[model samples]
Target: MAQVVTCRVKFIPLQLEFIATFVYVYNMKEDRKELWDHLSQLSGNHKEPWIVLGDFNVVLHREDRLGGNPVTLVEVTDFQNCIDNCGLEEIANSGSQYTWNDKQDARIFSKIDKVLVNGEWVDQMPDITAHILPEGISDHCPLVVQMLQSFSRKENQDREAMRRIQMQLQLTPLNATIQKEEKELSDKFRRSIYLAESILLRKQSNLD
Candidate 1:
């Protein structure tokens, strides 16, 4: 059985909007190909900033499985082909690299869960990441999709705010009572500059 749900999402704080699709798949080897084909067709139909994620029940690479039967090309081809055809790429992730683990003594682990997004999504939210939480009693780990505020976006907002403050300071006539307001504005402008520099340094370090 395979299920798919798609919806429009509005992130109010960031004012970011996009289409998100969730999929849950369960299929045998023969049926998996059909599922992949369906997903590929679905991706082709969507042109907006879109994200698709959930339990895919398959892996894309040999290293995604550990302490299990050696991964075969046949096991990965359909899923790889689907991703390639869909023009989707997995987002940056942290925490557990392997998302599923069998509880048995001879534990088997695999990364069958994934969060994938289209190029539009990447362009809109390049800093988004997925954090794989501890599985606990469940065999599959919980995935937390984090939409981080990009440094560029934050810097732009800060600069806009500072510009508004500067304009107000320039328009206001100098007076004894306005001295306090001027000082406050100056402090705010300095703080904004410092914050922008910090964000730039962090982005540079990440790139390095």
Candidate 2:
């Protein structure tokens, strides 16, 4: 059976900390129950923000597979039981729904790979998302997890400060002293605009 790895991650800028668990289940049906039991035990121990993700080698639902033998309740019960026991929720994802595809004329597609998080994780990072990239050479597609932190309060404060500065610049006469203040404020305003644009560009790039 594949080993389960757990680590603590700290986001320095946000002063946030969480537990991240990575899993790779052995592909055999009989071996998976032990893995599920182990994961459930781990989940019960961790109270902090936690995320577990990987190729589980099993589908959670019938909809998660296509062009394969019909998914039976017996095949999914163990996995579903583990999920409920762990209190883990699947992350919202974009791009392709199916993460694995057997490259053949009679193709088989399944969403065996997933990103799951606890309630604490959702409370800490509400905007977290997963993107499933197309499978190239490999049979399984790549999963890109993105955590978009909100800096709305800081951004709003900066915008308000800039607006006040602009009003002062517009109302004041262009004397030598006022001209110098104008130059300083203009530089600050331009810097803020540049920073905002940079942030927007970064988000757009992530989406692409």
Please tell me which predicted candidate would have the highest TM-score against the true structure.
2
Clashing pairs in 2: none
Give a tens-digit lDDT track for model 1, residues 1-208: 3567778998654445788888887756676777778778777887778899998888888899999798999888888888888889999899998999889999999999999998777544435789999999999999999856345564465456656666666777575446565666556455445544555666678799
What local distance difference test score does each model get? 0.77, 0.79
Clash counts for all predictions: 0, 0
Candidate 1 has a TM-score of 0.70
| lDDT of predicted model 1 | 0.77
Cα deviation in Å at residue 208, candidate 2? Answer: 22
Off by over 4 Å in 1: 153-208
Candidate closest to the true structure, highest lDDT: 2
Model 1: pairs clashing at backbone N, Cα or C within 3 Å: none
